[model samples]
Target: MDKGKNKWAVLVGCNYPNTKYTLHGCINDVQAMRDLLVKKFGFDPKNINLLTDKPGSFILPTGANIMKALNRIVDQAQSGDVLYFHYSGHGTLIDKPFLPFSKEEAIVPIDFNLITNVDFRHLVNKLPKGVTFTVLSDSCHSGGLIDKEKEQIGPSNNHLHGDSSISCSKPKAIPYESVLTHLSSLSNINTTDIGTHLLEVFGADASLRFRLPHVELEFYKALKQDEGILLSGCQADETSADVISEKGEAFGAFSNAVQQVFKENSGPLTNAEVVSIARKILANQQFEQHPCLYCSDENAAATFLPQSATAASSST
Candidate 1:
């Protein structure tokens, strides 16, 4: 932790109530994380922006609303600032039409609109040097949420439970049928291949297309030279569980494991250790999902959270 650094966080949870894809644990996951950040991590309540689908909440976790909140966080960020983005929701992949078998990962909002990995890369590129944006995504196909960041701990390097096929090692989009069903009716489009239909309408370059509302072509094309750390819930091709714990409380499996690990471990843990521990915790609980850590090797060895040394020490 850097003493002089400012800490900010934007947490989003979308349960998508009344919809067919409604999740049972997303809102609970965010609430738990908010409590951990405030109590254990020394984050200012005022500096944290929470977006959820809960009634009477200040903001809904729609794609446009999420982008607005994220932009505000990025705009106020300066050098030495520690920024956090935690999202517990549905995640999916969009297939690239031009690139054979290429897929782009995306996080689904309450309104069925998606915030794709290209958009995340665009956001990461805007961070000032020395500013760290640590994102924890508890969603399916979230292993590569940060676009081009290196994978420090994943299936390739992890042999947990003798399972080497747990990770996809690449971006895996949700099936087109799932997307089409969630999107509900795609107007007059009768084809079952939604990916092809999307490419035909939105072009091969998803980041450059304005076919969807609240999406800006040039805005998503912005790229920076920096990278961030991502703690994903599962591998690119696996589905994260939103299970009811033994205590009868619903929570995302990865989110629960992370909070539990930090709560139980009083000593400092590296990003690699954190991911490994979380993976084992999930495996022991009979979960098929494998938590992953994505970042540069140097960042992987850095402390788990970007707090000041004193603050980090105090928490432990």
Candidate 2:
């Protein structure tokens, strides 16, 4: 860790309780991550901000609130500082006819407000040099959450065969039509345009990528950056699993695999190494979802959470 530099993090988990989209393990995932950061990684408790949808949570994991927390962390970042954002929730894909891929990745906030990959690209472009912003998203279709980042590990045509024995698993994703229907009910706007529904509900707080013209969206996506690192739960076309263990504990499969990797390794591991190990763990456990790492080659080889000087020193 750089001496006197700070480490900041924003952890968000949305269970969407009491609704049709309820998830059982997202909150538990973030809580466990928070404990790991504080106990194992030497992150200060105060510097780690948490947003969840559980009853009486100080801050709800709404779209605007999530962005505010992220922006706050980035605004306070300085050279050599390490920043992290972890989100365990539902992810969705939006049709973007303007792009060659014909779709974009997004995370679903509690209020049906979706934050798109283009929005992440804009946020990442503002980072100060020497400040690393690493994001871990344990949600479905999260592979490309940070747009235009170099693909160190990505989708493949060959699917790894797994046991498929896990019986109580659910996909942590909401379809685009479902999101539009939910938003339409709230905004009283009946249309297929999700952008219109989001604009009506969130106004200026809505993601600009949704409302921007196709040309502007392309421009934002074209902006380049080296500061953003993403560890996704699954490939762009795959779904991450939320499993109910035999012990009745609920957690995201990818999140569980990550925790297992950390437990199995004592010394610091590189970003790519962590993802690679987690992918193998999931595959061995009969999961089809493949975790991915998105970053420059240099960052791929960089030590995971290297800014935690105390943890690094103590582990050695």
Candidate 3:
């Protein structure tokens, strides 16, 4: 961190407890990241915002709340500031008829409302020059979460398939059909249009990206911006795993791999370096998911977190 600048972070984890979508590792991921941001990266505890679905958590990771927090951070950020957002949860794809890809990626909040890639693009466009927002999304289908960004480490045909024999592991993905079924059940709307269901339930708070006309969505996708850096857990077509160890310890496989890389390296790791090391870690563990880095070539070579002298020395 530059002495003249400040660092802020928003760490979110959604373990949809008592529900069919429940997972055991997301909350743990958030806690570990919070510790890393404070002790290893020199972030003030007061500057980090935490949102989770764990019982008694004052702030829940609802879609509205998540967007609010992100907007607040972008609104307040100044030139040379360092910012980060880490998300550990289920990720899903939504149909986007106008786009060539045919779908858009989004992260699922605790209430099933989604925050889409277009939303992220809008956020990035608002960022001041010299300010960077680094995102680490440990979720399935997370590769392109920061829409239109350049790919540094992308999917390859040689990627290995996951080992099915690995016990106590679950993919952190909720299928589009399943999402529609759940939302229909909740809203009593029997249509297949996701936007309609979301509109019925969340109304004005629903993601505008979903409700926008196809022409507008196309226009938004065509606009380019470069202040966002994304380190996604896996390729858009792959699924990230949530694993439970023999001793009952649960964690996101990708998140654990990232932490392992940080522990094994002393000095600051570049955005590309961290994703590269994490990819190897996941491969050695027999996980099929391939971590990806998306940003400008310049950002790919930038430090994971701009660190103060004390923080850099302590890590060494």
lDDT leader: 3
Q: For each candidate in the order shown, give its overall lDDT on alpha carbons.
A: 0.73, 0.85, 0.87
CA lDDT, candidate 1, residue 257: 88
Writing each residue's lDDT as its tens digit, candidate 1 over 1-316 gives 3333788899998877786666677899889988877766778889888999998887788777787788788888888788889999888877654466887778877765667776687678788778878899998888877887887877743434542222212122345568766444643467654543444443533332224443454455434435488999988757787776555677788888898898888766777888988888877776777888888777788777645555567786
- lDDT per residue (tens digit) for residues 143-252 in model 2: 78888788888776645556544558889999988987888998997777778888999998899787788777767763554878999999977899888877788999
Q: Could you tell me the TM-score of candidate 1? A: 0.82
Candidate 3 has an lDDT of 0.87
The sequence of per-residue lDDT tens digits that candidate 3 reaches over residues 1-316 is 2332889899999989998888889989989988987878889899999999989988899999999999999999999888899999999999975555588799999899988998888788888888999999999988878889999899865565444334688999999999989999989987888898998999888887867776676665626547789999998778999989777889999998898898898778889999999988888778888899999888898888878777778767
Off by over 4 Å in 2: 1-4, 97-101, 157-167, 222-225, 313-316
RMSD versus native structure for model 1: 5.5
CA RMSD, predictions in order? 5.5, 2.2, 2.3
Given candidate 3, what's the lDDT at residue 263? 87
Residue 7 of candidate 2: its Cα lDDT?
Answer: 80
Clashing pairs in 2: none
Candidate 1: what lDDT? 0.73
Ranking by lDDT: 3, 2, 1
**Which ten residues in a row are the worst by lDDT in model 2?**
158-167
Write out the backbone clash pairs for model 3.
Answer: 1-306, 1-307, 1-308
Candidate 2 accuracy as TM-score? 0.93
